[model samples]
Target chain A: MVISPSKAAARIRAAAVDAFASAGYGGTTTRDIAARLDMSPAAMYPHYRSKEELLFAISFEGHTEALKVVEGADRPGEEPSVRLQELVSTFASWQAGHHSLARVVQYELTALTPEHYRTVVALRRSTTRVVREVVDAGVQSGDFTIPDAEGVTLALMSLCVDVCRWFPAGNYTNPEDIGKLYGDLALRMVGAA
Target chain B: MVISPSKAAARIRAAAVDAFASAGYGGTTTRDIAARLDMSPAAMYPHYRSKEELLFAISFEGHTEALKVVEGADRPGEEPSVRLQELVSTFASWQAGHHSLARVVQYELTALTPEHYRTVVALRRSTTRVVREVVDAGVQSGDFTIPDAEGVTLALMSLCVDVCRWFPAGNYTNPEDIGKLYGDLALRMVGAA
Candidate 1:
């Protein structure tokens, strides 16, 4: 069967993610992605105007996917600490499983054009907002004691994002172990009551 | 008089550091460093055999320099919490001040050949060992209550390494502030007394 337009776009984005993640963004070319797909570089132009655009597209997709994971893992009526633990642990495992996308999304922001960089940062801001809301809920419910929500958010993100650097394929540090450890640390960081 | 051999090497290394940090290790060329040094690439080959060798030399120098920072920051006789605080704060500042070297050292590891990777990893092992020693001391003295000293050490390193990704010139988060935030959170993570 012929590939659908959306499926084609996904393929292009996937190829770009690998190129940009394996080689730093500055080190890759659009032709590199096309070659990976066995198509002419111009063939990709219909889907993505440039490699930079494709990079941001994949990065945004990764953030959206992560948001869904967080939403899916939410426990409707659990205590705040329990919910926070589940969310952070799930986030770590997701990061480990999807490390290539995470690596490009987290590490290649600097190589984006100023406008594109701002766009990804906005996506980052929205993710920050989600964590903020979760943290705020915990604080309001008398389940936490963090005075600095931004700091706590950064700590949580740092824990999740850094997994890509060390947790590549066939590594000894298993995702389940990392997930549990990060969950405990994030919960303690906020002094969950 | 000709520049002393040591001075010549320092100039060459500084030139290479700037180039590699900007263009990345794989993308950088010896010609680029030589041009930056106002000399021909051939003239600089006496101190290094190849571009990869020069990169290895720079990588080795950076590895040793980082250990010094880790060692010097861990003061004896300080409270466990206080010492850990100082170590992170100083490390954050060290990252900011040496951003070029830090960028090159952290991000370019993938470019190393397997043999080179082993050497660099051994250097990393030493750095991890120092952090482990401090945590062990804290545990022995009843200052910290970590369940696994190794995992906690990995988490701490992850938090600090992510600093180079977000810290910008002049307006980056102050090392002391980061030190304060991470230290407080870290102590809480391990359920410190």
Candidate 2:
């Protein structure tokens, strides 16, 4: 089959993500990524300038997608507790569901170039800001009581983000179960009744 | 000064742990580890057979040390709330305090042989059991009103374990501060009064 450049690029990216997720950013080589996609290293080079660039691509895109998920999970005019649960559930579920991509994006931050690292950090801060603001609002409205909104928000994010570290597919609990459970735990952490 | 064999071994292990933490297991080489200790690669091999063995040594020792920290944190006859606080604060602080070693141990599990991985996992499970039993006791005594002790325990551990991933040294927050805050948050998480 004659594949277009965009299609070829997409295949190379998909293979790279899987390779990096399985073998880790440092463990994966461009040759391994190309091997998975049945392409020569020369063919892969056109789509990605280097392995670091490929990692940046996956890390950047994955984190950006995660930000979108959290931003979309928030609702206007909803009770803060209700909003908080939805946000945690949706965010946790997405992490558990797309764990491979999540692992690379979350754990492989050290491998990104300085510019890419800063950009990814900004996206991460935005996500953290979203959660913290929701939490701060909840505390302000008396829907939640927290000693430190930023710390609690970090713990909440940690709880959700760590799901990708341990929750593999075919585990006893599925992503939905984890989401619901984390949502409940998050509410309790925030002192929401 | 001529270093004794045991002292050389210790230095090699220490250097290996640091290299693996910064460069990752796959990216780090025996030469790098030896370079840090001012030894040739050939001299390094007499102490450690391969890079994987060094990684296994650091990982195994790190996990074993973590188990000791958690196990020691539990004080018999204490209230679950108090016990949980101590457990988390000590555990989290250790992770923060020994973050360079902690990072290699926690993040580089895939590099371990299956047997070594299982051994590390057993230590991890025992640590989890210690926390869960404490949480379960709290719930049974009406001291905590958690929905799922197991899930809550995991979340609690996650909150502590993840501090290593982001909290570098010289940051505004110290290990003790994180520990104190997480301890307070854990109490809040379990609905402790």
Candidate 3:
């Protein structure tokens, strides 16, 4: 059973995400991740050198993917309310769909090396900036009434980011359902006209 | 110097919270917590027999305190919008002020024993019910226009609960500031008239 280099690396990452999500970055060892994949630590060594390195990889990939999602969902030419609803619902649904991965990526970030941490934080800031720009545009166009752009942006990002934490609770068991609910709520939060 | 048994337990729990926050529950040990207090693990054993026991104590106490704070802040006799503002601001600020403890209590629930998890979750649901009732009341009085009371209530709680994850970011360093911002946003979420 031979796998391509990229395929092997992706498999290792998925296994590591599960391990990290269940036991946390500090509690999970590279060996545990290897065990999950049924690979020996030596065999896994070629892919990830250490636990922190694996965590960095996961964090980097997760944040980069998240930024892409938000950026992809943004239609700058659209009305601010429409832009926000799209941005939020897309981000929220992605967070829910990949919740286990998202949980590890979002919660275990502190375990990354400082350089890696800075890299991930920059990606996060970019994601936040995407939302902020939409909110600012909304406020400027008077399409949305908000008290303060910065605070509203923070709350919006917070609301979407937190979907990973509490999604699948009660009736919110589907990613699309969450997306719809959040989209409507985003409009309400911005006082959409 | 001798410490009262209760005080000793309190000190141990604080040390454990710091340990769990930095190292996570699976990564932290009773010995590490005892080391933080300059006490031997044997001495700490009387108060908390295991790391899981200490976590249960923290979860139980944190949830109990949080329930009290939410229930205390609820002014049922007031308008629904006013009641929600007070509830959200108070809850968000508490999450911020006790962010460290809140982080552990909120994020580490999966590591708790199933029995303990059930106990903590009931407390959480009770807290949610308090907010849900307010949203429901607001809708009944036509004071708030919301697509769904349950979703709105969930978002309100998620917004407040998430303060522990991203408090003190940028200009939002003060708990009161977070409270004020969240309180206003809660009204927007409910579409208060």
Candidate 4:
């Protein structure tokens, strides 16, 4: 019956994500999240004081996790084509594997408090920056041919970020397959030579 | 005050889109949408019996419009490369131009009734079919090369649909520019020769 403080907080967050994912941040109440965990609102109060705070927690964690994935995927000494393929495939599959949590993380930004929004936006920018750097390196090394790095980087990020929206649909049900497919497509998108 | 019934309904749908875009479908109430137009919920009931109905109306209209855009852009007689460029440019830019309404339409599908969801999804499939046909045409005509038409079509749709999420951000502000960028990227993705 007794759980550690961190474990309890993590449980509350997992429950809250499901609630918010199904009903949305605005539609979901702290009470609803509490009921999902079968905990009293008062018991849940110590971890997340308000709905917005729980959202911030989820947003912060998700963005941080995404940044780490992108960063870990990058191999600086590798050819730009290889780097981009790795980045896109890894990020896309991550988006798919954690789609429900990813959906809430991707879609509910406007619900975060301004300060929390900024923190999360910074994390997002960092993630984008990693892709941008690889894109720039590709252009510099002539491994990729593109009109502009900024625009190409934007499209690359958009493609990966959008996996959460329609993953496990049609024939693209498996995350690993998605990663492989996107890896090849990413190379093509950059005009890999 | 004397708006025609259709006009009144149109206005209501527009208001609901803004409300849903900001607060999400689960977060928004029909009363809130009515309040935005300074109309009582009683007056709004004739056009849309419930919030879900309003969402369905928006989804139906948005999907129908998107399908029309894709079909209109396809040039069956043209080279697949040219056809795809036109299709991607038009669809991406359209998604950008109508980003707010598009966001509501793209992200709020889970809020619709089962029948309504099916109806809207069919329209979506029609739109995707247009692009798939173009990709297949390109592959058959040797205008483009790809691993699979189905996967390419899915990526193409995802790239365009995601435009609403981050349009008008980081110098990619103009819808026309997005159109141009995506059109070029579509060619790259298909390995146009």
Candidate 5:
């Protein structure tokens, strides 16, 4: 009947994430999350004050994972064309693999509390800026010439977002398949070819 | 207030579409819908059996609209490439203008009841089939050399879905910008260029 605060918090977060992703933020209830964790609501209160806090936790985790993935894969001083390919490949692979979490980050925006929503939007913008920078660098070096860098960024990111919506990992099985295709498509779109 | 049942039903569908689009299907309620239509729950129930029926009506309406747009723009024997160009342009423009209803149709599949959900999925498959037909025709005619027609169809549909998500009509005011680019891009990817 006794669980450590840290361990219980982890269960609550995991349960909350499953609940949020499966049922969505609006449909999920704190009691529902607590039931999934097999813990009392009173116990969960010590870790997350409310369901909103649990949602914020899940969302922040998704964003942090995304940031780490992008920053880890992209290296400085790489060739514009190659680095651009690497960036998108990394992105599509990450998106296809971590689609549920990515869905939590991208599609669940309107469900967040206003303050938490603003935070997630800022994180999204930061990640998008990374894509924009790569596209601009490619354009500057004559490796790419997208008519609209910002619009291109939106398209590329939107492609990734669309992946989260549809790409069934089990059916596809290999993230590399979709990733490489999209990478080539993106490169050509930006005039990299 | 003795309104015809069909008129009352129409009002319910309209209110449901707006509510489902904005608050999303799960977040919307019969009371919210009735309030939007300036009707009491008692009065609204005569027109619709339950919330699920109203939701289904709205989703079906959007689905019908989408099929009309895609099929309406179809004209055979005028070059597969041109048919595809027309299809993508019309589809994307329809989505941009009918953003809310399109969101209901495109994003909220899980919200539909099981039978209705299957119906929507069938419509979606038919839409994709039409797209594949174009891609396949282009390949046979040497207008496109896409090794994988299915993948090309996915990319084309993804481009349109992405438009519904991020197409900002105000700033990205260029009509069918993403659609046109993707149409050309799809052709280029298939070696049509």
Candidate 6:
């Protein structure tokens, strides 16, 4: 059976994400990713210009998915409190569910090339903007008694993102449980009740 | 002026902590550490065994300091709410103030050898134990209303540790502001108000 270059590239990307997530971008090499895919490092060059390029691809793709996750939670004309809850629940759940990819996307920003780093940071700003907007809405509606909307927003985001750092998959409940727990906690943090 | 081996070792460790915090563990090299200290890589060997050894030292030291911070926050016979406020205020402030060191300690756990990793993990548990104890005390005293003590503790911690991840040294207010914000946020998280 012959594999097309696109199939090979997809396989390479999958392997690279896993390797980078596990060993970190600096610890992972093109050779290790190629070995995981049963391809030569030379073959990988056709798919990704360099290891950093593969990392940029993974980081870019991960942030794009996160943007989609948070955007999906935004319902037009929804109440502020409800919107904030949905946003935290969906976004935190995504972080926990796709933690391996999330780890690299969030933690390995330092490993990207300067231009790629700027691109990913810009995408991240969009996610941040969506979150801040919801929090601001909550504050304006008096549904959330937040002293500083920006600080509260940062706290909620940190709470959600840290799920990727320590959420144990097999030992505890699933990502939805975290979503609900953090959703409630976020409301509390924002003085919703 | 001749530098003693112990002094040189200390310099190397300091340099390693900063470099690892800035560049990450995998991205930093022994040569970079040695260069920062104006020592040869060969000269560095006489002090630390390897780059990983230096990383392990920084991590080990950081956790040790964190343990002290939390333990110091423990005041006998204090109310749980007060204890928790102090505990989080001090701990989170420490994280923000020494964020460079805290970053290496928290994020570079993956780079340590298994044996070194175990040591750091154990120290981290002590910090966790202290925080959980305070939350549990609050719950028992009816001073805090939390559905899941463990989960609430985790969220509170995630809020605090993340200060090191994004708190800019030259940014708004200071580490004390973050400590106070998180302390209040923690209270809100547990339904203390």
Q: Per-prediction DockQ scores?
A: 0.50, 0.63, 0.84, 0.87, 0.48, 0.61
Q: How many backbone clashes does candidate 6 have?
A: 0
Among these predicted structures, which one has the highest DockQ?
4
Query: What tens digits encode model 6's per-residue C-alpha lDDT throughout A1-193?
Result: 9989888777888898888777777777899999998888987888898988988888898899999889989985998778888999999989999888888888888878899999998998899889899888877788889868777887888888878887763333589888888888888888884
| Candidate 2 pairs with clashing backbones | none
DockQ of the two-chain complex in candidate 2: 0.63
lDDT, model 6, position B79: 88
Tell me the TM-score of model 6. 0.94
Model 5 lDDT per residue over B45-130, tens place:
87787877876777787787787778888888789878888887777777777776777677777767899999888888887777
lDDT of candidate 3 at residue B62, scale 0 to 100:
97
Instruction: List, residue by residue over A1-193, the lDDT tens digit for candidate 3.
Output: 8899899999999998888888888788888989998899999999889889888888889999999999999998888888999999999999999999899988888878889999999999999999999988888898988888888889988988999998789988999988999999988888899
Give the range of the ten consecutive residues with the poorest summed lDDT in model 5 chain A.
A167-176
TM-score of chain B of each: 0.88, 0.94, 0.98, 0.98, 0.89, 0.94
Please provide, for model 5 over A1-193, each residue's C-alpha lDDT reduced to its tens digit, 9 standing for 90 to 100. Answer: 8778887777888777677677666667799998886778887788999877877877887887777777777766897777777878888888888777776667666767899988977787788878888888888888886667776777777777788778873246577888887777677668675
For each candidate, the alpha-carbon lDDT, in order, equals: 0.78, 0.86, 0.92, 0.93, 0.76, 0.84
Q: TM-scores of the models, in the given order?
A: 0.87, 0.96, 0.99, 0.99, 0.91, 0.94
Scored on chain A only, each candidate's TM-score is 0.88, 0.95, 0.97, 0.98, 0.91, 0.94
lDDT rank, highest first?
A: 4, 3, 2, 6, 1, 5
Question: How do the residues A90-169 of candidate 1 rate in per-residue lDDT, one tens digit apiece?
Answer: 88888888887888888766667899788777777766666667787898898989857777777787678778877842
Alpha carbon RMSD to native, model 5: 2.5
Per-residue lDDT value at A7 in model 3: 97
Better of 3 and 6 by TM-score: 3
Interface DockQ of candidate 6: 0.61
Instruction: Please provide, for model 2 over A1-193, each residue's C-alpha lDDT reduced to its tens digit, 9 standing for 90 to 100.
Output: 8999888877877888788777777778999998997878998887898998988888888889999999999995899999999999999999989888888888888888899999999999999888988998898899998877777887888888988887852242688988998888889889895
Question: Residue-wise lDDT of candidate 1 within B89-148, one digit each (tens)?
Answer: 666667656767777788778767789989988998888777778788889889998767
Ten contiguous residues minimizing lDDT sum, candidate 6 chain A: A164-173
